[model samples]
Target: MSKTQKPVDELSAEEAADELAALAAEIARHDRLYHGDDAPEISDADYDALRLRNAAIEVKFPELVREDSPSRVVGAAPSGTFGQVVHAKPMLSLDNVFSDEDVTDFVASVRRFLAFPADRELAFTAEPKIDGLSMSLRYEGGRLVTAATRGDGTTGENVTANIRTIDEIPQTLPADAPDIVEVRGEVYMRRDDFIALNERMAETGRTFANPRNFAAGSLRQKDPEMTRSRPLKFFAYAWGETSAPLAETQFEAVRRLGSWGFRVNDHMAICRSVEEMLARYRAIEAERASLPYDIDGVVYKVDRLDLQERLGFRSRSPRWATAHKFPAEKATTVLNAIEIQVGRTGALTPVARLEPVTVGGVVVTNATLHNEDYIKGIGQNGQPIREGRDIRVGDTVLVQRAGDVIPQILDIVPEKRPADAEPYVFPDKCPACGSHAVREEGEAVRRCTGGLICPAQAVERLRHFVSRNAFDIEGLGEKQIEFFFNNEDPSLRIRSPAEIFTLKARQADSLTKLENIDGFGATSVKKLFAAIDGRREVPVSRFLFALGIRHIGETNAKRIARHYLSFEALRRGASEAEIPQGKGDPGNSAWQELVGINGIGAIVAEAAVEFFAEAHNREALDALLKEVTPVDEEPVGDVSSPVAGKTVVFTGALERMSRDEAKAMAERLGAKVAGSVSKKTDLVVAGPGAGSKLKQATDLGIEVIDEDQWFERVSG
Candidate 1:
């Protein structure tokens, strides 16, 4: 564990919940950039770390899991540039393991779940985990019908025309193949091809970042002829939505795919034991660089189809398969300077500028410093890092791409440090707005207090409001947000969310028209207006999240929206809720009610109350609400469910399912899952060791039932 992160065992439930919310939002944003846009901001290692942290927290506090948790979501939603194709079978992602011990545990978990004796041999197929775009080719009656890119697991972009251009993907399957089969494979560009392509495009000044990105860009091209011009290959490894059984085992199925005119990796092998699995992984790693395409790691899957069926899957990944990722690559570089970048949340993040160096085939010029403490060789728990040797300008620092993607400084070479190098000083004020930057207790990051006044923060917040996960206005993105924020004409400028909805009206009244702008043409300006008008009514959850309240992300926003059912109700609740006076203060009824919702805590309640209480925030919110209507979220699952819209609580041990699972089930039945029993609780599900909550429920005259009875009532 990094010193900056608190141990999972040590984190309080409230802290865990807050961190989970933040991680979900951060990961979602990265998913949009990486999966939807094919432009990643962080390296693979950094992304994995965030996910691993989330998993650890979820393991320690399972009941705190939110509906929008990263563990439950796959790739981002389709970008809407192509026709949408809903997968017949969901295209789930694989859970990742970074260490040998984790791999061993994974196998042990499979045996434990299957109740298999230790002496019995279990076979698994180990293959190279490709680093490329996942494409699903659907065949019907031995003819190719559609090819789609995995988009959020359930839906994908229809790239059938583009896919047909690749010779490696067969236009028709062999007669022996299933009548309907979705052959899942990876579309990749060979390293040499990628290099040549870059060289060819150098004259145009538009080169790709990596082979994986190049393959994705080529496959997503709107014109099929353009895709045909690119050098792309496919390797089939799995199947989805098969009309008939293809084979009895994993290896056999892959062989059948190869016989049916799909490229199957020759390096794939069957491993019957843990030792064999590890040996195969090592062998694959040794030959990874020599391969024509990139392989990030080795994927191991249960070979037997029966065993795979029994193991089934988790919410987002297979229970019988996992990806064992390769270790990060490191290099040494000179640190020239440290720069501060302010985020929409006012976080003052430090970035280290380094002399250009190559690590893992990618050019490295910058790395994340994390925070002031990290730069000063101080850990979050006040421990020493790198023997308490602080980093300085001109120091030769060891850097690595975390997950072969994100560049990060590991430590400095003391002998290479310049004699005149001085201890770096962290700024106490915002670099953009000159406002005080203060670090709060128990927090590692220092934040700017400038709020909306800071240009960087304002622009970032505006961008986030129009982000894919929020309001998601089609014509409004980061570049457009920045352009409008700094526009010279007052009528054309958009510094706040309210101004966006009023852009057309403002432009109509002004002497200058948007069409006359440098980048905006008549057709583009009309489309922008239509896009803005399309978002006049948004879901209450998205509306709440767009406000960007501290400690409130998409999951927490949804929780609040579900609890209150409307923006007006949530605002009223926040206004009536009183902040606790001290450590032991119980606070007012409204506060108690807000905190009573499962996955919600005092931290979130306080933040929501604080945001609503601020005079400027209220003024801006009132203005924005005038232009947009926030609609209540439709009830999930069966609207006629007996527990629909009812507040339900669970007490004691649940034998049939885990606490988190029970909560999820109840939620699916359109019931509100509460952490504590109160007058507002409509039902209570009690089990073995039922205690205080059950008594409280009885005293409140709420309906109480045993776990089995509760399940019986909700079962469809």
Candidate 2:
């Protein structure tokens, strides 16, 4: 065979493999600094060049790719606070090319390959790449169906229940629409919302490092209510599978999406040629910092749908799309303190609390300290850490964020620290609980032995139980619930979350007396009671989740409930189990058996076993059961019926049907109407202004049904 050009043979197989791993590690380090950390050593153009070079090298040596490579990964792992979801389609990273030369080369490559005439201009659509979580939304028969993260391409975690809470995502579609439509977009926390969220976190002694992380963490929450509480907005940028084409060109498709009430990216430009595309890219680069939200880059896509298909894709990214990233933001800030935080799993993270500093217009206050090893390398002694010395307390440090989300601490400044400063001291006991804390083998955290009694654990766990994912008690926010529970010690101890349910019966007079307290009016008190009353009958999945078993998230809870069928059965089964398993239930086999069921992991199973073993937890559960009931499994809806057995999510504004009315109608028709869409979604009823759920539906290839058609079919 004649070779057009010999591939670079500078490195042999072993050498190339080693270098590839090193490159991936280096890039991932930089990615943490850029995307997660918000600090970059390189300029926008330089970073783009580096990424491009990496991509080129990887492209040439495809076998060197690692499963965890930054180039192959789309978003960071989901935060521990929310339930995780895998996406149906892998959220692929975009390829970026900088400078006019790069754009011209790209155009040349497309033209030469497609055999287009030089005079024939390639109409390219340009839009701002919103620096937020990329999501897919599905709509069937004009009603919203499901929303999901762009996971590993074939499957993703179901986030449909949570996505429904975003008001910006329309719950229904216009009077007329396609049978199936999927819309793809970004879910972003606005600048103001991000600031407010951080402020709230600060007041509660919690922290939100940046807006992008906050947005991603919020959007992925198991509780739709929590996602809705954050000021999350969606801007439709692309489409997934469609029964019929919405428009011919990318510009027209975006316009139609807007017309159909989708929040299309407002900052978009039409470029007629590669030169124009370059100009637009540069213009966006210049104006990146000035935009209301963060944007790491500008994106260019093939205008024609057929052309995009023809161009096809590589193993990781699409051939049709590319992102032109701006420079990474970099700045210096004083390392005020290094504080350790315990996550739900008891991972102790060292955070470099910094003096407020701005990079790329956004102010940053904290950066990741990594771990004890990183801390020691940075120097623990009073001596100031130079770049060579790593970092030390009271030293000035460099910071960066990529796409303006994560915050990373760079080198330390020795010149700024006082001569008498001492090395930072690691704490031996839990800061919140003051319990005898010990760092377990193979773990980074020094955990308190307080268990359920720890104030922080008790408060946080209580919050989680009533969170949007659990009992979903409305009117009881994090602060309000904490205020009530935290104060119980002086008067009485609230040992369990089920105590909240029994309060109405045991403390009806006290509850009335609460209205007379400062800042507590009768209206507010009534609202709280009403909210509590509304949630007396929660779904089995939610009830299981509300127990606050470690690692037993919404997905696991659902699976466990489905397997056992009833709480009595589950409790009996767990009691009969001989060994400890999932979630570590302190070496209890019964706990292991619970998690061994489908969708239940060892982490969750152990937690359930541990919780049931605790006398306090069992007592609390009994109290809760007295006040509330779990949602029972409904009989299967008739498959012959149009809406039967299908999970339907609603989005956007609906003129003909109120959302509640539609949900009621769906129930009346024996349809299993759901708040969010997942892999199980049968149809999505979309409306004008339908948001990410529309994209999720189309991507899954589930039917998208519109309201008018829905009315017609169901009514008939």
Error of 1 at 365 (Å): 1.2
Residue 429's lDDT in candidate 1: 96
Residue lDDT tens for model 1, 454-554: 99889888987997668999988777898899987888899999999999999999999889889889999999999999999999999998987877766
* Ten contiguous residues minimizing lDDT sum, candidate 1: 198-207
Which is the leading candidate under TM-score? 1
How do the residues 576-645 of candidate 2 rate in per-residue lDDT, one tens digit apiece? 6555334544444344335435334555555666677778767777777888898864433355677765
Error of 2 at 462 (Å): 1.6
Which prediction has the highest lDDT against the true structure?
Answer: 1
Which stretches of candidate 2 lie above 4 Å from their native place? 1-124, 130-250, 253-264, 271-294, 300-323, 342-349, 370-390, 413-423, 488-495, 505-512, 580-595, 634-716
Clashes of each: 4, 85
Instruction: Write down the lDDT that model 2 would get.
Output: 0.67
| TM-scores, one per candidate | 0.62, 0.58
